[model samples]
Target: MKIIVDRFISDSESTISHISVDQRFVCFGLEDEFRAIKVLKETRIPAGTYKVALRTRGKHHQQYIERFKDIQHEGMLEVLEVPGFTDILIHCGNTHTDTEGCLLVGTSAHTDPENMSVSSSSIAYRKLYPLVVGAAKNGSLSITLEDNDR
Candidate 1:
């Protein structure tokens, strides 16, 4: 599976993006603002291609399994080996403040200069999780993060 995140709008506090899988639209994504100097929990990962996998262990995993009981949750969709970052996962949230450096997904998006947000987050996540897990099962999964929406 090939996932692409087009980070189109970036500001002081948030980066708003759209996500696609295998050239098909998936959802909107939200991440922390890009920063030359990395700040823990507040900086977006660098633009790069990274392998993705299902992280079966972690607090996020445990929480998701419970919260998404109807989805047959496999594991968190983790973006692997991002330089200077760890435990980067594609999950769900409403705003940049909820991201904590992880990618957040939603059905709809809104962006302003300093604040970016998304809505219907859990609904988006429920729709996305299975597709990623199925891909992981069938073959390889990877994601390319880029600033292409300019």
Candidate 2:
């Protein structure tokens, strides 16, 4: 699986981006503000490529199992080997407040930099988790984060 995140909006508190898989549009993405100097959980991961893996153990994984019981929930779709980052999973959420340097997926996105957010997050995640997990299990899965200035 080739996941691509195109970050287009950046603000003091959040960043808004679009996520695609193998050249196909998938969902909207939200993450903490991108910073040159890291500020613990308030900074987004740098623009680079990272492999994806199935993280079976973690707080996210445990909660996801119950939250996504109706879907084929296996493990958290984790982006591995992110420089200076760990447990970077592609999961569901509404805004930067819902994440800590991790990517959140949603069906709809708002580009207001001051209050960037995504909606229908769980709906989007249910559709996304399986595809990512399947690819990770089958073979190599990777992602590229690119910054597109607006």
Candidate 3:
């Protein structure tokens, strides 16, 4: 499976991207602001292609299953071998604050009334988790991140 994230909407606080699997739309994604210097929990992961897998062991795995009970399967989708980053996963959230250098999946993107940034999350994750898990089972999953602004 090949997942592509085209980051198109960006602001000082957050960046929003359209996610697709093999040319099929999947969801919107949220990440933290881009930074020239990496800042813990506040910078987006560097754009690149990375291997993805189902991670069964870890706090994120347990937390995801707890929040989304329907995800009773095995593991959370994890992005592997990102240089200078660790534990980067495609999970659930509404805003940049929810991402600590990780990707957040959402159904739609809208400016947050309070923050002037994008939100509307969780529902997309509910829809996406199962599809990604199924893809992982079939073969290796890889994701490519591209900054459309560039």
Alpha carbon deviation, residue 40, candidate 3 (Å): 1.6
Ranking by lDDT: 1, 2, 3
Taking the tens digit of each residue's C-alpha lDDT, what string does model 2 give over 1-150? Answer: 799999988888888888898999888889998788888778888899999888899898899899999986888888888778887888888888888888999999887758889999999998777667788987578999999943
List per-prediction Cα lDDT, in the order shown.
Answer: 0.87, 0.86, 0.80
Off by over 4 Å in 1: none
Q: lDDT score, residue 115, model 3? A: 58
Model 3: which ten-residue window has the lowest total lDDT?
A: 111-120
Give the per-residue lDDT digits (tens) of candidate 3, residues 1-150. Answer: 889999987878888888998899988888887898989888898899998888888887888777778766578788889888888888777777788889998877875533533345667877777777877765578899999854
Q: Largest lDDT belongs to which candidate?
A: 1
lDDT of 1 by residue, 21-132 (tens): 9899899999998888889999987899999888899898999999999999988888888888998989878888898899999999888777679999999998778778
The segments of candidate 2 whose C-alpha lies over 4 angstroms from its true place after superposition are none
Of the two candidates 1 and 3, the one with more favorable TM-score, higher being better, is 1
Give the better candidate number (1 or 2) by lDDT.
1
Best-fitting candidate, scored by TM-score: 2
